[model samples]
Target: MAYRDQWKMLHLLNTSMRGALKETELIEMGIDCYPDTIQYLKDDGIVEMDGTGVYSLNPMVRRMLNKFMIAMGAGDMKEIYVDVPSCFIVMPFSEEWSDTVFYDFIQPAVIKSKMECVRGDMIPRVGKLSENIVKQIQRTGLVIADISVPNANVFYELGIADAIGRDVFLLYEKNIEQNLPADIQGAHYYAYDRNNIPESVERFAESLIQWKELYRVDVTLKYCRK
Candidate 1:
């Protein structure tokens, strides 16, 4: 794999909207110690690198590594799904039609790490996305949405996610304060002002992780015993 994709994979594993470590960050983190970490992992037959930095993860192998990381004090499972106004850009364009800059940065890591991650962007219509949100909530760990605008898309998805009793996360530009409703104010929200995109995103992701675990435990107990 090329340095760029290898770097992307590492970021996906290590980053959350809580923080992003750029290329320079990795170099400082010891990209020099193993200028060929990807090759080493590959040659050792641990990582499978493909064309132009693209790589396929062997899940069974990854689980073994994850086990080690857990024992060594690696943290909780990290995941974030980007739900949006349009599925216009979900990647693998020819097949899944779900490609976007956001996906580009995040998807590879999620798939490779065997992390629980997903996104909702395909429904171009508000009503459709709303219904789909409920369906997804059934299996999702949490929901993150951007309603920076009084968009029909974000509003309805938020509604459905709440209605289904799934934990809901919200992000909106500081400017949207006037447009959002009183009820929504009670839902967890983070406002990114003037393009401070990464900060708000990270907060929502981390909070969702905590919220999701509680939901999971409570719901599991409710259903399992009944």
Candidate 2:
């Protein structure tokens, strides 16, 4: 762990795609990056300067860091303060179809893509249901919205995800694609058949993998003082 401080900095920077780490902010995290460590990182090409005194992880290096974290196990990263990426599912709950779609299709697909999958109903109630949903949407890196039955709550949740700029993946039953609201008719979606569970899950998983790589989910991690 000769470069443990640098490792910690990269883990934190890789957590978000948003902005760079300013030199002053590094001091707040108790990181010594003024000249020596920052020069070490620049020489290695692991990070790039966004401006005069700000730096962010290089895109390719970020991907490598993600792979390293995965290989080392998410739990191991948590021990070092890295946040795990997660996908939240937005769908109508307590319906017969809900169980089928979540278990048979969505959950498996999310698992295949190496991310945690959670839904509104799955979380323990803390305050209002709407409030919890909003919190989860904001916390998650990606959102998967199922608009198969035109449920009002689902639509509202989907709108929140959109407003907050989370990476969203729309899904629907093939039969209802034509009946979807005109507002979202132009949006891209995956239509699955009820009878084709396994195949649909595979296709959805593959598509999700490709989409994640292209968009690079928005994730954030803050340095916690020990």
Candidate 3:
């Protein structure tokens, strides 16, 4: 109805997304968003409503689209610009304690270092082979994954990420049988002991910091002949 009300609606939608709010789950903060509005936005190509009730961001060439939106004074300036470097995180069981620490503690540490971290639960889709997982893997420039457990999907996705030339930071639980396929043993990796997750995480991060690039340029240069 009113411009202020429309802005409020955008705020609610943005909050739902940014806070990882689900469609059916209402926030205690009181948002009165209706399904129809969400659908309308999707129809307008402003958002993408996929299988299930989850809503996904409708990305645009903001550098170009925003120029038009701004020249016409059509949208909020704040909404036009936000930096969240896409990060793909693959793991085995999501509820594992180490997973939670990565979600709660280690991920924030990575994000604080300036990156947008997305987890399994926060993913818009479910099941092992959903488009959400696939798209995230393709879009992400960085991947921090664990292949300690016997997960076919993890191994499959790891190989795919490698094929796409992603900068993957591999991790596995120490003393545990690596679920990775022997064929892909050439993939780079490191192990961690959950007994000292913090220290192990610190070690992982330190190794990452000391590296010259996300992907090994030197190794690639040397292996070009072979």
Candidate 4:
């Protein structure tokens, strides 16, 4: 099977509710020799099938396809089917500082907003750090960045999130002088301190809910206009 045909098959499976496909269904969609294509996809670890011929996309491949669709501005399809919004945290990876923020503020706040929160350190270090970070960022619906320190890795990840138009929330430790770069100087950020963590968590959750509502409205309007 040609590469394009394989893509079509994968796309169909991806957009389906259960990510399940049958040989007959593929043929009905005008795929020629779909069994061979399915075999090819299986060989590439892109899909898996049962003994009953019900095929489904591999979880990793499905996530990659979702990210691709988002990057391509296919927001309508992606938003409509997304089960849970994910927020990626970009912060300096330090045991003391990162753990305190993650457990005390970030995790609780995001869970309260009913969204999943993931950080770079949570991911398995199986590949290039830069590539892995960007891939995780691409898959998220939003980004929460902590710029309390002048961390290069955090800044780089934040840039990728910004370029992709992901809704972002900046955070900083209170009383620290923030010399934000020109690109993000005008952006609003939440300030927190150890003394006011509970209050900050409440505010952060509220802010995320508001941001998510606004994002949904914006996406809806854009798609309607098109």
Candidate 5:
């Protein structure tokens, strides 16, 4: 497949349920040349096309397409090349605690680990907000979620992160009554306060490094066995 055609085909498949698509749907989506693109992708072994013009990505290729979408959408292609881990910080976006959490804890911890940090606020507001958030989370190597204030948005993003099996680090402020939801109560978290920003940063950095190491090992072993 030509490069652009290949990308278009993959994009349509990734966004579709079960990565399945029909020829009519493709034409309606403005992909006038989708027939040739589907053939190209089929020839390249990236997609399977049936006699009825139904196209689907197998499990493996679907995952790769998802990663490609995230990289393209979030503009984090550098992370793929340099092997620098990226983190997504999920927290309340309001002015009250955003600055303190970002500057005092999240930024320092991420930088100390030589990782790139992305926040919801950093994403351009040009697209669907929830889709943008999901893409950012998909591109990240880690997620640091602050659930101190019981914000619904924070929890929603946290659910997405956890659902995707990303390494998640939970944080909450000290002295707050943390009635963690029942589902996540068993998860370990870091409790911090303004007075201990330095300590919190240090511990967070260490934990991130350790989690990265473990994740690397786990991935390596899985692929090796396969």
Candidate 6:
């Protein structure tokens, strides 16, 4: 298969809204539906079409392609598609806390590590918010979850991130680090001080850089074949 075809197919698969796109939509989006490329994927069962001419990627094939790309040690896969490595923060959101914890603390640290920082509520989607949250969690390279307060929704998001084997970094306020749930007692986490915001963020950025290095090492070691 041509590399351009693969790239075009992958791009279309991700950019399609509502999980499928008609050929006209592809053209409007400036993507050409090369007949040979489409036919190749169709013959291989990698792409599907409906009676009305909407195209969708086969889910299983998409999964296999993603895993193969990852296993080939294409860290972040930027060459194949335009994407900035992003970190999805699973945390309790409130007006004050969003500013204090996320905007001030986590966002700077994530930016310092050269990644986009996003939260579940920050993403815009036209579906159930929960489904959007799951999709964001799946797309991100790292998950930073603030378990400072025992909110059920925070823990629920954390569970979803954990269940899907995301690289999670937990954070909590200074004194409550020891009070985390038993299930995540052994997980990686950091404690931050609210009063010492600047210093705390500096320390968090340092840790985040180290975490990114460790994450890269882990992925390369686990997936890169000798």
TM-score of each predicted structure versus truth: 0.40, 0.62, 0.48, 0.58, 0.59, 0.58
**Candidate achieving higher TM-score, 1 or 3:** 3
For model 4, state the Cα shift of residue 193 in Å. 1.9
Look at candidate 3 and tell me the lDDT of residue 221: 18
lDDT digits (tens) for residues 100-201 of candidate 3 = 657554575465445567774467654344445554665454677777776767766776666544557667777775455466544557787767767766
**Candidate 5 minimal-lDDT segment of 10 residues:** 217-226
Residue pairs in clash, model 5: none
lDDT of 6 by residue, 116-174 (tens): 78877778875566666666676676788888888888888887766555668888888
Give the C-alpha miss distance for residue 216 in model 4, angstroms: 3.3
Clash number for model 1?
9
Q: Which parts of model 3 are misplaced by more than 4 Å?
A: 1-85, 126-129, 177-180, 211-226
Better of 3 and 5 by TM-score: 5
Candidate 6 has an lDDT of 0.66
Better of 4 and 5 by lDDT: 4
Write model 1 residue lDDT over 69-133, tens digit each, in one string: 32212133322122211111112222231233235433432333233556665433444443444
lDDT of each: 0.42, 0.68, 0.50, 0.68, 0.66, 0.66
Instruction: Residues 103-196, candidate 2: write the lDDT tens digits.
Output: 9889999999888898777876865666666667755767788888878888888877665445677888998777877776434588998899
Q: Model 4, residue 104: displacement in angstroms?
A: 0.4
Model 4 ranges with Cα > 4 A deviation? 1-84, 217-226
Distance from true location, Cα of 150 in model 6, Å: 1.0
Comparing candidate 3 with candidate 6, which one achieves the higher lDDT? 6
Instruction: In candidate 3, list every pair of residues with a backbone clash.
Output: none
Residue 35 of model 4 has an lDDT of 60
In model 6, the worst 10-residue window by lDDT is 217-226
Candidate maximizing TM-score: 2
Candidates in order: C-alpha RMSD to true structure: 17.4, 12.1, 18.1, 12.5, 13.0, 12.6
The clash count for each model shown is 9, 0, 0, 0, 0, 0
